[model samples]
Target: MDLSRRTLLTGTAVAAAGPALARDDAPPAVLVSTWDFGAPANAAGHAVRLAGGSALDMVEAGARVAEADETNASVGLGGFPDREGHVTLDAVIMNGRGDMGAVCALEDIVHAVSVARRVMEATPHVILVGEGARAFALEQGFDTTPLLTPESEAAWRRWLETSNYAPRANSENTDWPGGASDHDTIGILGIDAQGRMAGACTTSGMAFKMRGRVGDSPIPGAGLSVDDEVGAATGTGVGEDILRVSGAHAVVEAMRAGLDPGAACRRVIERLARLRGDKIADHQVALLALDRQGRAGGFALRPGFTYAVTDAAGQTRLVRAESLFS
Candidate 1:
């Protein structure tokens, strides 16, 4: 389970799966995102790319799919609420040109990613928070509606009995409709035919968390980072840990230092493990990266992390990412 052994195992798995795409033959357009739910999101984003949309357009379009999925309890509409029974969303969007925007602890706005985009385009500020974010969204024509559904409220009530607040690894992949999800964040990264890059991250944050709790989903360097000259990276899982190391930005810097997308992601996971030691086993921090050449890869602190990839051919598939622990 050490880093070197894990690297060897991951390398063997990669070899068995297939060789990495050659840079010269890399797809002109590619989309990659976190989790199984990301499959449909990738398809949506890919459609934007096929329709001649910019990377910015592709990422925003993709993130909206998950934000509107009623069955997903870790995102928009039915997301699990905080201990106070309020569902506050966090989201961020960034483009290769360094333009970025974010909203944290935002309430009543389902398309938080789009609001983040508006923050980037309409205001000189890069972030908006709480009531201010909601006000901005409303002024921009976004409708205000309750995001917590009956199922989520029931689950929150059940959670009050034990009041256990331990963060769970990969809980978002569980039976979400039954309100069994926690701490799931959807992060999407894309490259257009023009080779432009963009990334987005959104989530309702950890289930039954403190009322004002905001995770890495809305933090630029922690949840998402994009660079036209290098690549883009995004993370999902326990946000606090990711924030400590600026995980997403670290992955992009590693890629800029000449590592492949997978290697870059793995290197960041290794750093996170070293930083947290044995405690890392109790939480998951998965990272997905896409290089400027359209190559994509993902890595995680533990098993059970999967990402969706959509290539130029319009084929979308889920990839189970390699992990530091067996």
Candidate 2:
């Protein structure tokens, strides 16, 4: 046979190549999302990615970022004020290892959720709130910024210029205008490949809300849930009803009872709906869940609810909830 350059090249390539090079290794992946307001909702996913941190670290860091961002308008300093025009903050954290922490109705602390994490780790109690929460934050050396941002101050100025009421508007429909502020919440659920989990939630009360009004953020099982054996869940929506429903815990339990992540979320939603007689179409909640296998799913009433999630394949994407039940 006559030797040719092409034949020589083919033989050399086969000889140099190894049999083990069949598949490329997967990069990291995360699924991120949020409600109408953005920013903080997806920030947790970002923190987790940067640190390769567990769910607990991610949730705390994400919440602190939102709490510190003046423009977010939902969780921290720049959030709309209560009826008297004062800002307040709330936060909570939980680990699947049976540790929990929270701070509610806090004021002036730039990173309320971080303070709450310290309480969970350092104190004997699982929750703390109000003046005591602030005192602890100060004692811990957490920095304090002006309670109101320029955006928030301008919002307040407009409120003063426009009307006597607390600048309340209908978040869902301005025409039907009900509450004064969004009182929206931010939560996270972190899961490791070993099946460990952590969760956190943060928010300011509804703007121009009744003085001393406390929501579900400080309540366990309402804001978030982490169960090393079953799965983890984080809740969003009306706080009181969520607490009553034990929303996140219920979602986790549903998974324990053989429900898939989607079905588990729907089951909890159905429970909430049923509690309200299933009559009010406006009732809403959102959730994300991950099993030991890293299989994940999400559910919500409307089209826009979203969660940030990371998978073993190293693919990260934003997951907008759909009516998996319907």
Candidate 3:
């Protein structure tokens, strides 16, 4: 009955327990997310976890903060519209128990993450898309809201004049007040008071993208994946590059194979470069991972990707992502 010495295992994740359990849990739980804007969600999730909430609930609540922010152009209510002027959202939520749900290319629903959770808990299906997703959200009692605000509309109009689809180098994540956009998603991973892990991925997809285009955000393994015993992982930036490798799942698999969080994130980015060097040379992709023990690591294709972390003491701050090019 030596639980401390024996290895703890998650569905496909395994970890040495003794040393990890001995590490500081001062702020006993940990929350990590993809970008600076995630600071708010990290704080919100931290509060819930500190109060003995489930990590799954914290992750969902945290993600909802961004989903409701009209100023954040990459996710939720006021996100930049697609090329055709429609603001479609995609989101996914997964818990330590392996239960998961997602919504893709869903229009008019601001709380897309909540809708995704309903998909995971209320229905037998794992995914719902387009009108089906909208219909389901409505059925779930979520009211319709305008996703594309006047500010976003004007930006789409301005973009239409030149009609350029190529994303600029190092696009702005909060350029809404400023048309110009990774700059991509708010992917979060965390461990709760009871040592359970959960993760969530939410985004409005690429700015001014093709109307029906969907990215890694709504795809479980690509955008987010969690194994309560081992850890959880999430990805941001260019969803296309992230999708090609199922980025988040790759990180969790690496952890299962004995790589620490930092090493796992590095290996994934290196593999991505090896597989799509030419296509990803100019694009950005970033990953953030947390082992069940509360250790975390973040890696990216470029230097601008920053992530936020909060410990059990209610303290939170952003960590700059390590880049392969650097």
In terms of lDDT, the best-performing candidate is 1
In the range 1-326, model 2's lDDT, one tens digit per residue, is 21111112221111111211111221322322233333344445555655677667766766766676676676786887766677888888888878988888888887778888989988999888889988888888887776777777676677667556422222433321112122267776665444466777888765556668777767788777778888777776666667788888888898899876667777777777777664435555666565544445566654345444444443344334554233
Predicted structure 3, TM vs. truth: 0.88
Q: Write the per-residue lDDT of candidate 3 for residues 37-70, one digit (tens) a residue.
A: 7778988898887677898889998999999998
Model 3 spans with C-alpha error above 4 angstroms: 1-29, 173-182
Candidate order by lDDT, highest to lowest?
1, 3, 2
Error of 1 at 63 (Å): 0.4
The lDDT values for all models are: 0.83, 0.62, 0.80
Looking at model 1, residue 51 earns an lDDT score of 97
Per-residue error at 298 for model 3, in Å? 0.3
How close to the true structure is residue 113 of candidate 1, measured as C-alpha lDDT?
97
List the candidates' TM-scores in order: 0.90, 0.77, 0.88
lDDT of 3 at 161: 99
The alpha-carbon RMSD values of the candidates against the true structure, listed in the order shown, are 4.1, 12.2, 7.3
